[model samples]
Target: MTTSVDHDVSPDSSRRPPTEMVQLKHPGRVIGAVFALLLAFLLFRSFLTNENYEWEVVGEYLFNEQIMLGLGRTLILTAVAMTVGILFGIVLATCRLSENKVISLAAGAYLWFFRGTPLLIQLVFWYNLSALYPHLGISLPFGGPELWGGETNKILDLWFVALLGLSLNESAYMAEIVRGGLLAVPRQQTEAAKALGMSSWLTFRRIVLPQALRVIVPPTGNQVIGMLKHSSLVSVIALPELLYSAQLIYSQSFQTIPLLIVVALWYLLCTTVLSMIQSRIERYYGRGSHPTTPTKKSLRQRLRTRNEEVAK
Candidate 1:
């Protein structure tokens, strides 16, 4: 006698009863969606009808060479600043979570001072730091050659000063963001990792950070967009970033509003792209936290099992 293995063959889908309709309607969602559409339409109409916006001047300088150069500089500044800020933010966050009082307090105090001051003031301070110290250099404790610097302008140009200011200021905010992410993870997961013989650094790198990113990413995306626009503050230091470029053109041509409009449009474009990127990243990480819906094959398997049970 031969033993038979059961085959999970599904009944024909066409023979299955029709699915019941879902009657759980959300009236609030429907009303809110409609209101949002109407508001968007009204704003679009207003923008199209507003003749005082100087459409011609905006069109003329929107892609001017100087404006383009400034846009490039703004992108570069944002990338470098955010990178430095995030790297240092991780360090600060880790230090803050450490057991040592001196290290933790030092990190906390750094965050307090940086976050307490206005970023504009920070930019100005860095720009004028040469006045405070006159020169920047590093020498051996026993006295050796000055490692760097002849003049402040030569050593720290407006570019470096703006980058330094933006980075230091951003670190304060990012540190808090990162710290919150670290704290959000369950302590038991870390304990298990340590029990498994993982080193502190390895556990943080391999496990903690990936889990923390789900919490950290949304705020970090907002920070990235904010950093892009905040680079405009560099215009105050006469750095030829996008805003300064627009200002330069408007001053000579005497068409201020249109140039500003151009600047605003560029900012909107950059932020829109960043927002799209943020959405994709959120969806990718979100998958791990929530159960995924069954696919067609899984549904078939379930149906076959159900049919077998009915036959039995």
Candidate 2:
């Protein structure tokens, strides 16, 4: 009995056969990628080689004084409008979140009307507002004595109207964004702040806002970029912002496609810069909050471990 050694339990019992790995083939995916690259190359070649694009004229007027001026105005309007929108949006979001029914209702009504209406329609209406009210002034509740008055056309000039429409419309959208960010802050965080003897405003300003900014900043940046594009709508009212400026140049020289291309290129450049800034801001606010990404070696190790367990 002591001499009965089992041949099946050899010294190499722990050793396992090597697993052969075969990568999955995806010929369809490779073919599709090649076809797409070829199509893109052709399109890019056409942009350079096509005589109809008038690349020379585009180069000539890309930085024309008038075009630069229009771009400047467009940037200014975007800044001013977004500033007003952010400020007013914060107020609206706060009011909507308020305990008072009347304040919340009023904020809701404002959001409803502005968000429901088309921005273009709002811009046109504001530009032609002198039609509805010839003069604007503050007066008594019962239409008693007019304390002050001014011609509507003079008071609501093109710049003023453009700002009014853009800011108001943008505020409505921003309110929702701000409100959503505020809501993302956990209820427990606020409670903890309250326990630490922080006032409501202080809690929001300190604990809540810093955290909520991580959520708010990304969308707010997108809104800033959108405001740049939306500012072009003011061209309808002859505000002579970027797009309108291009239209003016083209209308005279009959270089419609080239001038339009210049405008598109400028817009693309601006949006690209804004996108980079947005990415930086998001990373700043998101520091220490997001989990670190796994390195390739770590990922491969994890997969190997999983496969070994599955084989066992």
Q: Tell me, by TM-score, which candidate is best.
A: 2
**Per-residue CA lDDT of candidate 2, range 1-312, in tens?**
479766787555665654544567999999999999999999999998999999999999999999999999999999999999999999999999999999999999999999999999999999888899999999988869998889999999999999999999999999999999999999999999999999999998999999999989999999999999999999999998999999998889999999999999999999999999999999999999989999867767777776786566
Which residue pairs come into collision in candidate 1? none
lDDT of 1 by residue, 1-312 (tens): 999988776675335553333357899999999999999999989888998788998999989999999999999999999999999998998899899999999999999999999999999998988888887777666777777657776788888999999999999999999999999989999999999999999998888888999999999999999999999999999999999998888889899989999999999999999999999998887667878888877777777777666555
Candidate 1 local distance difference test against the native: 0.91
Q: For every candidate structure, what is the RMSD over all alpha carbons to the true structure, in angstroms?
A: 8.3, 3.4
Candidate 1 all-Cα RMSD: 8.3
State the weakest 10-residue window (summed lDDT) of model 2: 12-21
TM-score of each: 0.80, 0.90
For each candidate in the order shown, give its overall lDDT on alpha carbons. Answer: 0.91, 0.94
User: In model 2, how large is the Cα lDDT of residue 87?
Assistant: 98
